[model samples]
Target chain A: MRLITLPILMLSMFSVSTFAEEHVVSQKNKSFSENKISINVGDTVHFLNKDPFFHNIFSLSDEQYFDLGSYPKDESRSVVFDTPGEIEVECAIHSKMFLLIEVKKSEDN
Target chain B: MKTLLFYFTLLVSQLSYAAETEPTDYTFIAGHPSLQQWLLPTPIPTPKDNPLTAEKVSLGKMLFFDPRLSGDNNMSCATCHNPMLGWSDNLTVARGYKSKALTRATPLIINLAYNNLQMWDGRIKTLEEQALAPMEAELEMHADLSQKIALLSGIDGYVTAFDNAFPDQGVNTKTMAMAIASFERTLISNNSRFDTWVKGDKSALTADEISGFKLFVDPVKGNCAVCHSPPNFTDDGFHNIGLASFGHDNPDLGRYNQRRLNLMKGAFKTPTLRDIALSAPFFHDGSAQTLSDVVEHYSEGGKVKTNLSPNFTANTLTPEEIASIVSFLNALTSPHKPFTLPTLPQ
Candidate 1:
């Protein structure tokens, strides 16, 4: 019974790792491609710049605050969602660009 | 003779139609399709809640020009944003309440309708949000809102004007801001020679001006368009374009006060270059004296490089290139139309 329980616990832990997903959000024409996106906790969001110029994506939100600095065209910056809450993201360079990220708890959790 | 005149009119109409139907895909300079982005959009953007009306504009103009709204019953918005002086005071730094010089230059009110953000720090999001800021600021107009409201409500002319403008809204700060914003929306500057050139008038700009324009867009050359983008000539972005002022102790942290980001420190909103030739003594600190001086600053890649904007890079533009760029900037000036002053309410 103990051996069976250990195998079941290992399978559950492996499933969580396997299920973690990555989402792509593009910055084009000084605006974020997605106005709002929903992602589960442990998921990663990749911010890709498609514009000719640079973009500095940052979020001052209490839930996962980050400043990606500035990256040029074709470059990408990523952030992993560890907390479950709404995050408001914006470009430091262009105030017009905004992205709202909704991080939800993983189904297993 | 009648037949000839009719044929001439028909021919002119056909030519106009042809010009209008011409594909926008055609490039201004060879290999630069991005130049088409320089055309300004028509019908200025306004909040749906506060649509522009003649009555509103009239009321706003009165409020804007009326000095009675100030704490001292003196110094109207026009005192700093004077129309004769390019909608700016032409002062190095703006003089606030009681003739105290403020830290930053009084930003021009030109083409503000297109901006999604307002003020040097972009602390405000709309012109309506920006209108009452000076009137309330301790160092600016410094008007006691309660007293000002009482005074305006007392005036029969103002009461009638406000009623005409806002109907059921009544005399209040919101309506005043909305009215002032409505008037400011009319301050559009999109008819410059460069605009004419963008509209396909090849003859509008001279050879030197065209060359200067090419240099302005060339990433390795002028690279001005990277920040001072198309149409309104602003990217609606903020940059810490390393001015000597940044080197000063306790330098103005500009956008950082609102944004609280390390990059935002010393960053300020990128001002429009539409009527660049008009407003002199440029930059937030009013550092540069002339267009040439402005170009020189960029050529040196800003004075203080410690926290320079990532977008800025030292360029190697020659004197000729600089002159041409300045000439191109001069082409951005729209012909000044005579402004009719609004009659103040007694």
Candidate 2:
């Protein structure tokens, strides 16, 4: 029973590492690098601030809600998309910056 | 000789037109590429749906100055946003709805055409969206939209004017807002001393004002450009600059009202400093009476440090530096143009 549990845990870890991917969206010139992007569920998106000032990126979408408190240049914050839907992201500081993310159901699911 | 005289006369007319319509040459700031961002783009941005037109501007001007639109028939858009008062009321807080003191100061509408968002807390997205807010607010204009529409429609002059401006739209709320926004778009303030300097005029700014500009952009010194950025002298961003009023119990939660986040608790929109000198009594609360007072507040970081904007920091600017910064701000004022009062449709 212990041997069977260990194999199952190892298989789950391998599956996550293989299926999940990461994407980077840069914040520069008071705008997001990508206006819209598509990624599978369970994938992570890193919001990198490339501007000189600070930016507070937040999303109140029902799919994935998050508030990445203001961070300065070269810093980055990330979030995992667990649900399959659209998420609209915006900067609390600069209203001009906006981003939309489409999370599709993973093929494995 | 007759043909030569005609050609010479045509040349003079063409030259005058070129002088008025030509784009500014930004080669003067070539030494500092960073300062290039300070130049405002010409032919002001306008929304696609609400394009500017002479008829619309004329109708909007009349509506903006006509007091009959208000509930008491005493207040117009120009009452609080007086052209003589730097497009603002010049009060600590606005007097709204029968001389009642408002919670916030009347913000100047100058150069709002360049803003991506509107209002102190950034609740509205466009000038068109914000045009009727004061009229709708109970503490403000307190005008019934249905009644105002009926009143305007009853006037034969207004009816013709609206038809001319909006074609098929008539005298409706949407057409009224679009017309007002079209006129507001014409309130451009890009011809300041700083603009002249950027346009290759070396004598536009004084020596001390130049030094002030340097300190204003330096991160360790005045550091004002972090939020009050270039072009329009605004980043179109929001920040909580730590005013003393933020410490009061049940203090105003500015941007947090729209976007619920800890960082936005006291955040307010960063206003354009294009005509900074003209619009006296600074900040949303109108606490700073002078530019010197404003510099002092920034030097001390802020009056209330809690929930302060991450972009702001304590500076060690000397008295001379502060004075110089204030001098630089004084140069931001554009020469006022004569505003003609529009005749209202009776």
Candidate 3:
């Protein structure tokens, strides 16, 4: 019973190592699903436009900067947080739509 | 097998009952509970740093109407934001310092207290930041900041008013901006025929006006309610609603100047539609001459469609329907109040 449990734990650890963290932030009703989120460096955050209208995602942050141009409903864009810092994400069209992302250093690094 | 059949029968009956309860008439649409979201909030939201006070309001009112705040000492904020003309100058485009014709129209100061951003392009984030802009701008008031502050500091009447408004802070740019913003916060409009109708008065709107409202909300119809939302009638969002001026050689970049995004190239902040009828020659460029002209432009899905907002579409509204929408817009104006001009301090 001990041998079987040890192998199961090792396999789960391997699986976790192979997959990088990915988060989905949906835009609906001119707002983000989450106002803020935390993730490790190299983790990807996907912005999904769920509203009928177009939404543009961009960040003029210190560590990471990106401008995902406007896209219509059902479309999505992803950005990888390369640095460990706070990034303010906002929709260009809708000024009120704002999200803050806290990126931490990867433990493996 | 017998239990399965019984459950299926129950489900079918429930579905039919639900179908029966679904809204099917105009009465249900007109009196929907969701309509209550359109009511304006009271007691007005103010920043914690600059809470509203009678002293601040009075001081701000004097500064707003005082021409001595300018470089030439002839033009005040009231020169362009005339209270009689919907708090705007009612010009095709604003006349700035030395009677220079500006590129944009003088936007009404009405209900600006509720706005998240200021100016047509939304460059300024707060009213405090906005109050000092025209005075400092070369084309507007053209006042030197230090000189203006010095002038205010020397005046005993202004110094006393500033002391009363800011208490410990005394006379300075920051306190002056806060006081002006506090006064501007008082400029709000919550009373209108449409407001009364929203507040449970069935007789407030005519049948034609009600139909126009339906058209305004309908996705396939006028679709005005998409941007001009409830209460304040502004979504506080920016859009490049294709205007004819956008086709010009050197068209204004608007929000693009601030954000540097292609989508925001010609985008301008969506202004409040409350009392919109009074502030005519609409659009950021002051292109449309009248309200009908504005409706007509939207009906065409915008003449210059390049880079047009995805939200806009060719509205298939008839002449009568257009007139009805105009009639509904007319009901947005609140009853006028006799505005007494503030006495300038010597």
Query: Using lDDT as the measure, which candidate wins?
Result: 1
Score candidate 1 by lDDT: 0.85
lDDT of 3 by residue, B1-346 (tens): 4333333443343234323321111241444565767778888989999999999999999999999888889999999988878888888899989999999999989899999899999999999999999989999999998998898899899999999888889888999899999999998888888888877788888988888777776667888877787768887888888888889999988999998878888899999888888887788878887888888788778867788766666777888888888888888899998888887777
Q: Per-residue alpha-carbon lDDT of model 1 for B210-312, expressed as tens digits? A: 8898888777899888898877888899999989999999999999999888888999999999887888889999999899999989998898888777888
Q: lDDT for every model?
A: 0.85, 0.84, 0.81
Q: Which ranges of candidate 1 are over 4 A from the true structure? A: A1-16, B1-26, B29-34
The residue pairs found clashing in candidate 2 are none
Pairs of residues at least 3 apart in sequence or in different chains that clash in candidate 1: none
DockQ of each: 0.19, 0.20, 0.21
Error of model 2, residue B234, in angstroms: 1.3
* Deviation (Å) of B141 in candidate 2: 0.5
On the 0 to 100 scale, the lDDT of residue B216 in model 2 is 84
TM-score of 2: 0.89
Model 2 lDDT tens row, B244-295 = 9999998989999999999899889999988878877889999999999999
State the fnat of model 1. 0.46
